[model samples]
Target: MWTYQHSDFLVHQIPALENNYIYVVADKHSDNVLVIDPALAELVRDACKQLNITPSHILNTHHHWDHTDGNAQLVAWYGCEVVGNAADTKRIPHISKTIHAGESFDIGSLHIQSLDATGHTIGHIVYVIDDALFCGDTLFGAGCGRLFEGSFAQMWTTLQSLAALDEQTKIYCAHEYTLANLSFANSVDGNNPELQARIIKDTQTRNMKLPTIPSSIGLEKHTNPMLRALDDDFCSAYNPGKTPLEVFTDIRSKRNVW
Candidate 1:
């Protein structure tokens, strides 16, 4: 488990199920914590115990099994409110509250805003709490999620929305795919100095068995190939005279096989 602290929230990054990440965000003042994408109940339970905090809510970014597998168990154990995208009520288990894009809520003193991130899944949503973005599989460190139930245009639009956020916002995407994603990013934008530096830095971090997550929007904008689909260089190479959506489609298709 890796821990990161914001001004009023504490985030725990729990590694689970191969490369998946389950985040536990707690309010510093109230100790009210919300579990994000709890794939493994035991890991979440153990982390809560160690942190001396109990979960008060569960936030699901999507309906994927890996993201919501422990939702029922956690809710049963904590009697917590489960929040998920309103459009995915049928899919997310034990969801108590359905939220939509631009909706804001309060957990203790922490303010959270939900953004529709529907490319990874049709009803995918990301949570923005303070400076942290609890983006599930919709976005990754150096890449974005596969278009499982949405279109390339949807994914591209979703990513563009995230890219427009505060550059310093820490992206808490729910996966440990930095190394692999950066490798593919290197292939796509090989000439980017920032990307090259990130490849070396992330390689060392992975070699040392450390987590390379919580990447900033600024860093992603500078190095992430998926976010750079609109760049002139990227468009020249992969899109030619095509639109950003067309370039994004080609990049995503290539990543599917990569």
Candidate 2:
């Protein structure tokens, strides 16, 4: 095994399933890597070999096929343990550890805490390790997950909890929806300069074809309109005469078509 250095967590932005992102987190210090929502099994394997590491764990954030589609293949190739939301047992393949909220585990030196995030799915989880957050489809840079299997209330509360993490936490959301989401944010919050700045930043990143992810929690709090559903000023500007829930529902509906 190769000796490890600093920042063992290797992030590979796999653009697949049409804009979805699947990250391969490897800790070289431990000679182990955890595949978070492996979009493709071969992709995960190649990523590990690229860094001379092996897959020890497969973490699924939700039961979505885009996220867990590589489960069986990864597990078979490396004999990794597949851990996922306790509610996704039957749907997602190879989920060996069905976890719940507050469940904590370790992969070598790093500690992983599972926070149940319900908006995306009943058992959708946000994995917290040190100052990093892997929030699958539940939370994005400028947007959030749809009410596919959960409710607005659940989504709102879950997002609030995630926001409470350290401001410096690197939020690795599982999609490349930032630019599109930021566009919707600007349309909804026309007067927000922070939103404008984000749009410009996103454009530059895309122009360079660079990864526009792993946004800071602090930045998301300032610019993400979806996460500001409770701000009275934001709500009023979003929909002049609508209630908070109405504003949220309206924004969500419009973004659905955007």
Candidate 3:
């Protein structure tokens, strides 16, 4: 388990189901607890026990089984209100509140805004809480999710929106794919010194059996090749003559078989 101690909340990242991370956030001011992507009930239950919290809400980023498998059990245990994309209500188990992109909601004193992230799946939405982003399977540390049920354009648009966020924003994505993603990033953007440094740092972190998540948007924008698909200089250097969308498509296609 890894914990990010915030001034207003304590964000607990519980490792489960191989690389999946189940997040339990405890609001310090209002004492409100929330769980994001509770992949397994037992893991979430134990984390909540350690924190002495009964989560009042559950936030689901999408309808994938890995993200929603524990929703029913947690809702039964805590009688929590489950929140997810409005279009995913039918698929997200026990979902009680549906929100659309750009919608803001309050979980006690915590303010959360949803952003459309429909690449991995239709109706996928990521939550923005303060400076922390719980982006489940949409944006990885150095890569983006595969276009399972969305177009390259949709996924590129989503990535562009996230890249435009505050540089200091902390990305609390759901999986531990930093090392692998960095390998792919280096394959395409090998000349980037920042990407080289990230590969080394994340490799060391993994060697220590630590979570290499909660990557800053600044770090990702500088090191993630996928995010650079639209950069004019980047395109001119690596994929000259390709339009922004074409560049994005080429990157995603190459990553599919990487």
| Winner by TM-score | 3
By summed lDDT, the worst window of 10 consecutive residues in model 2 runs over 1-10
Compared with the true structure, what per-residue lDDT tens digits does model 2 show for residues 1-258? Answer: 112122646565566666767777777467777878888888767666776778888898888888888988888888999998777788879888888787999888778899989987888888997777899998897999988989877877798888889988888888888888888888878688888888888899989887678788888988887766767788776667777667777777788898
Top candidate on lDDT is 1
**lDDT ranking of the models:** 1, 3, 2
Order the numbered candidates by TM-score, best leading: 3, 1, 2
- Model 2's C-alpha root-mean-square deviation from the true structure amounts to 3.0
Candidate 3 has an lDDT of 0.89
Name the regions of candidate 3 deviating beyond 4 angstroms.
none
Mark the regions of model 1 whose C-alpha exceeds 4 Å error after superposition: none
Task: List the pairs of residues colliding in candidate 1.
Answer: none
What is the overall TM-score of model 2 with all chains considered together? 0.91
Candidate 3: minimum summed lDDT over ten consecutive residues — where? Answer: 222-231
User: What does candidate 1's lDDT look like per residue over 198-244, in tens digits?
Assistant: 99999999999998998999999888888887577778776578887
- TM-score per candidate, chains pooled: 0.97, 0.91, 0.98
